[model samples]
Target: MDEGAIEIRQLRFGWKPGECLLSIEAFTVGRGERVFLHGPSGSGKSSLLGLVGGVLLPQAGEVRVLGQAWGELPASRRDRFRGDHIGFLFQQFNLLPYLGLLDNVLLPVRYSRLRRQRCEEAPAIEAKRLLAALGLEGEALLSRPVAELSVGQQQRVAAARALLGRPELVVADEPTSALDEEAREAFLSLLMQRCRDSGAALLFVSHDRRLAEGFDREVALSALTAAPGGVQS
Candidate 1:
């Protein structure tokens, strides 16, 4: 059988000892699948994404990506592994303010040779192609400082950055929180299309239930996590 893009089995985590933040018996996102994961605030959703991306390790059990256990890798290897295999669209749209849009998108290639090698063309050309695919074409816009772009534009730039080298897995954490309904739908359509074209599995986490349609599967965070009855939101 093919390995899942993400797998969490018998997982337990906590910021403090004996205080469990997340306890999941099992959860998985298959290769090339689009999964919409929804839950209320303070549901350990972002923390779960962190674990999947190898940013955080579970205290017990295992979190694996592409069938490799994250806890088994050293910190440096974990970093390189994540750089090579995982693309993340953070909640805040973490684009550098000092760089232009193209430069911001090219950052991943600088860190991961595998990512750079996966590009069909030179990194710069590929960056422009991704930006263009997201409707940010033209030198005028590509050359502009990323800081000056509007929220929606910046979000697209961030998405372009995450999708740049066709990483196997893309984890988006509340990526459409700021957009209006029309823009959100348009952005999601484009994002899903890009993932499909790249054969990348998408693990999209959001509280907004309206955006759940069109995904291959919809799962609630509450369904996967085993925690106390009430946790602060």
Candidate 2:
């Protein structure tokens, strides 16, 4: 049994007082499972990802990501735990413009000793290997400042950063929105292949249903969630 995946029991969350937005009876994602969760734009999908990635706390019940409940750890420990075991890819690409592509890819290692020690080949070697596998070339751009790279290049670098340390869980929210159909397909395939290679559980969130067909499993938020039961929007 892959008990290291996310397990939610009676999960409920909301912003304001007395307003419970996400209400889930139960949900589980097994290890190595590539899950494509789709929902409408305002359906609390990103919030769900936030909860799974330990960025948000539930008003009731519990959220367990990779066998550890987020609430079970102290706040500081939760931050470190997220840095060590989980890699999140936001649509923004979140790379520092001043840093080089190699440095941006190695950023996780600075905060995560486990990742640093595991990717021990002088760090840059691992970054290079990952970037190459991710279909990126040209050391000139790799060493240049991040602001100089194109959007696609930046996106690939973001992927390298997310997959660098072989995090147990990789959460991506609308990562392919900016790409065309061909690019989207290529990126999705690469992401799935990388997750399989590293044995990481992928939880990818997007509103586009057509792009989700290739994943190991598909989850629709409307099927598993109710907005606070009696609560209003």
Q: Would you estimate the TM-scores of all the predictions?
A: 0.97, 0.94
Residue runs of model 1 more than 4 Å from their true location after superposition: 229-233
The local distance difference test score of model 1 is 0.89
Q: In model 2, what lDDT does residue 167 have? A: 89
Question: In terms of lDDT, which candidate is strongest?
Answer: 1
Residue pairs in clash, model 1: none
lDDT measured at residue 219 in model 1 versus the true structure, 0 to 100: 97
Q: How accurate locally, in lDDT, is each candidate?
A: 0.89, 0.85
Predicted model with the maximum TM-score:
1
List model 2 lDDT by residue over 161-222, tens digit each. 99888888898888888888888888889988998998899998898999888898999988
